[model samples]
Target: MSRRSRPRGAATAAAERRASSRALPQLELGRPTSRYGRWRAATLVLVYVLMGIHIAHWRIRGRTLAPLELNEVMYTLELGVVTAGFLFMATVCIATLLFGRFFCGWACHILALEDLCAWLLKKIRVRPKPVRSRLLLLVPPLAMFYMFLWPQVLRMLEGRPLPTLHLRSDEQGWASFQTTDFWRNLPGPGIAILTFAICGFAIVYVLGSRSFCTYVCPYGSVFRGLDRLSPGRIIAVGDCTACGACTAVCPSHVVVHEELQRYGTVVNPACLKDLECVAACPTGVVRYGVGRPPLLRGWAAWKPIRRPFDFTWGEEVWLALVTLGVLLAFRGLYDAAPFLMTLGLGVIVAYLGLCVLRTAYQRDVRIGPGWLRRAGRVTRFGVAAYAFAAAFVVFWGHSGYIRYHEFAGHRAAAEAVALAERALRAPGGETGGEPHDPGAVPGLPDPTSPTASSGDPMDEPNIVNRSASRAISHLEQCARWGLLRPPRLSDTLRRLYTLRAEARVALSDLRGAIADLERVLRLDPGAAGVHYNLGVLCATSGRDEDAVRHYSHAAALNPTDPDVFNNLGFVHLRRRAWGDAERSLRRALELQPSHALAHFNLARVLAASGRPADAARHLAAAEQLDPRLAQPADPAATP
Candidate 1:
């Protein structure tokens, strides 16, 4: 209901009637007789029913239309995928331009969730008081900018060319309008639950109905802007009585009667065109109709409609700063927190912070008719509330510490891996067209030799070693912190193990690297890339049998990967298994006819089987494919 709407108590209604219509005859305010809420609720239910059917179709058919989410605009901006979400958002924007945000009022699942929470609270005799601040309301627009505009701005500044708009099939992943993996863009189960709890239930109970749309939803901000230009609006169709019933039933807090009185229409952008105001107007004066859009209203007819806010200007500033800080603090905490969930956390925490301030400083403070402080003295309730707020603040501080280490560890590991890749690269592109098999770092620092003292820092083995050491230390520390409070996703811990394994490889600690990789496989046995990497490491360490086993597993998981077959063939050749080696090499050649390493290995298999003519033919093919294959010191020479 409208923020200034009086409660349904007789005394409150009498006061509102006397104050709002002192000149006219007094009229009793009555509850809305309209069934718009029922219709809207049914429409929202149908939305969910369709969503369920869509998911079920994907499960049974193995493909479906991509999820229609406004946030998919991010992929459109960054990757140029003209997704179904992008088209849906555009259609909704156009609809808002004509219908004044009817979708938000009648179709959004989040709105349904908020209304359900509000209903449940009312059933329990709780009416959550809405907290309004000038600064906090800017959050929606700011978030809209961050989500939809910032990526392109960053790309322009970085001088990167915009990606070509293109479509991808399900096999290619992240298709524009269709997908095989339906949940690829969705959050994990834990994150989904947290999102519903925080954004749906917690925000509604703490900040009142539709507060997320007002203070946090980026998509709502876009619609709000479009709503200003829509001709469709609540307008006065007849005259006279202003008993304020229209204002008393507006769920968006739009102060409808005041708008109709001031501008002869509800010009407030917050209006969702729910028609509650129209249904509640006792005089039948208000109705929905097309008129001149708010922008077209001449200044002479335009009047400033002042509405009261819950916070003073200084408190609004404090609210904005605290909310921003808490938002950044909780965002992606434990690698599981989603953005909307974190935004709700920020708003709720900011409200609690304000309550603490008021209880501590203000005289005669009450929360929902229960006095927190009386006559400049604290009550027991006040003390308990203060303690709760303090504890929550401490919890947030600890979360910030964990998030810091997670980001730091990832940053360090990325740098170490990049440096190690540079260190391992051949100096002159000597491998030609041959695939650089996984886990092969050719120019690694020799375990027996002293560190290189080259003048160029890039040529120094000591620098690479030190970077790898630093990465290992950070990653280990990150894992230690994670153990103290385990993340909701096992993938986070799995990634830590995989990254640490790469660092160990850079340091030439083959045994330590194998242990870390094995731990990763335990966490995710179907990790085909991990299996391939383990195979290369085993082959490098002369465990041909183990190498063959891992390579075979990797091949089974990803049969289309030609490099897996080629590397498996090399392992077989090392074990002198001529028939198995020839079969594997031929399979690799069939997958990729230009695979130089497979041809080179087949040459060895043929020679060992006493086929000199075939050996010479395969050797000539390998040399023609990669001129560097003719060189003596090439490591693939004898494998």
Candidate 2:
């Protein structure tokens, strides 16, 4: 059976050449057909219909089965929420152990999306050339580590314990099984659309069909590992013809004939077992069969691991750097892009980046249907691509700038807060009372000015002198950028303003702090914490009327907070509004019976109103709760 003597239909020269080049070659024995396509298509359609009904049930009934998303594996690992997705993934893994990787071929929505995109491109006669790189193949497994293992690693580093595993119902909110908020774990509408566009369509068009499964899907990496132990496989059941038609029809781009010839079975983890090859085999040789798993096959199993990569060493390095840059630039861009979408975007950008570089340096380059460079000259198509890439680079640069400022501001603010906390906790610094009491105003040595130092570097006053200046500067820059671009950093403006207020408070600038808090309210009028902080600042500044107003607003926003009611009571007591003062203090005690501050304040209100008996009882309770609230050594001193 010499090559020339074998049947021409068995292995055409063109088919052999295409197979060697790792491209989809036309079959000599007519176009290869898929027996499983219609069934898989119908199954995918039914899956989608069921998904719609699930969403509808949640909408109409207000609670339903939790979303069967694979990513809920994160919740199971990090928070110990045993979600439906966690159970679903466990079921699939068990099934894969017995029957191989059929879920991906027949059930995955993303796979359906890639297939549809490929079919549409075929209609237009556009065959995408798949780009293969060894470095790019590391992405999925690396992503799997980040998704499932990194959080636990961080928790260990931070000396945190694992969360307790528990089930929850809808009434508890954000539950695992029956969730009222169906979209809580899902991405926003904009992100969902972008995910579909990039992962489903763009990656397929740019890097060939099923590119997402190969280069970006973290879940696929898990399944691929599990597939190594699966006994179910596509094995040769009959004759010895190698026409390469099975490879031509494989949507996953697996070289079916090569694997079969080397291992006597489809051992590639990339094989989805869609059975396209079974239908395409002219001799009826390929079929499903039980066999020893790869693990049990010993050293002989390693023979089929000689697939050639598409890039040289230098080009691989370039692809790695470009892809990493694109991933960092696009991930969480404008606080919207999700990690998976960014990974797909990275692959596309890396491909285009290489094409652009080739257009400039290499000869006879073509992308899609257009010649980018030919005969060492740049064509009009090359210029157009260059223009588009240039615009994209500009956009990337701006996004980088915004991210830098946001990150820097947050880092500086964190340092400032740590410094201020250290100073407040220093020996001879503000102490006596509970540091966390929201209703208590600081009685500083100099209420009207920043603390004066005795020219000692180690002095607490000197330590906090410039603690927040740098933080304020960075935050101001970030805020300015956010202001110029509405909705760019709009979601973070409230947080920025709140942090700035804390920084101002550290500097002993109560007015500046109040102004920043007012800005926070403008951003988020319902923020109870901001209102409470503003009330404290106003009380320290002797603006009793404004303090009462802010405390009232805080109380309305968060009725469960006893601190707000206590603070409002104190302000009313200062203004000599006895009835109002007593009511607020009593409400505070109702929320928290052990609130010493509220008891102390209530006593003051009762004493001012001449209810001596009631005042004495509350005073006794306050003194019992906190002995510091008792009368000082000097009889003239009032608590």
* Winning model by TM-score: 2
Score each candidate by Cα lDDT.
0.74, 0.75
Writing each residue's lDDT as its tens digit, candidate 1 over 1-639 gives: 222442334235345545644533322333333688778878888988998999999999988999998898898889888889889998999999997989999889888888888767766777776666678889999999998888889999999999988877777768888888778778887888778888888888878888998999999999988987899888998773767777666667666776787778888788887787777777888999987778888764343353446666666778888888887777877666778888878888788778778764456556654667787788898888888878987887767776776667567666766765665433223222333342242223222223323434454344555665565565556566653444533455465455556545555677776787787797789988788878877877778788899899999999987878888988888788988988988998999988888887788778788876887788789889878667453323444
lDDT of 2 by residue, 187-282 (tens): 898789889999999999889989999999999999988888999998888664777878778778787887787778887888898888888877
TM-score of each: 0.72, 0.75
User: Which residue pairs in model 1 clash with each other?
Assistant: none
Candidate 1 Cα errors over 4 Å, as ranges: 1-33, 298-306, 367-371, 426-463, 466-473, 483-639
TM-score of 2: 0.75
RMSD, candidate 2, Å: 8.4
Query: Pairs clashing in candidate 2?
Result: none
Off by over 4 Å in 2: 1-24, 27-33, 155-164, 170-174, 303-307, 407-479, 482-496, 499-507, 521-639
The total of clashing pairs for model 1 equals 0
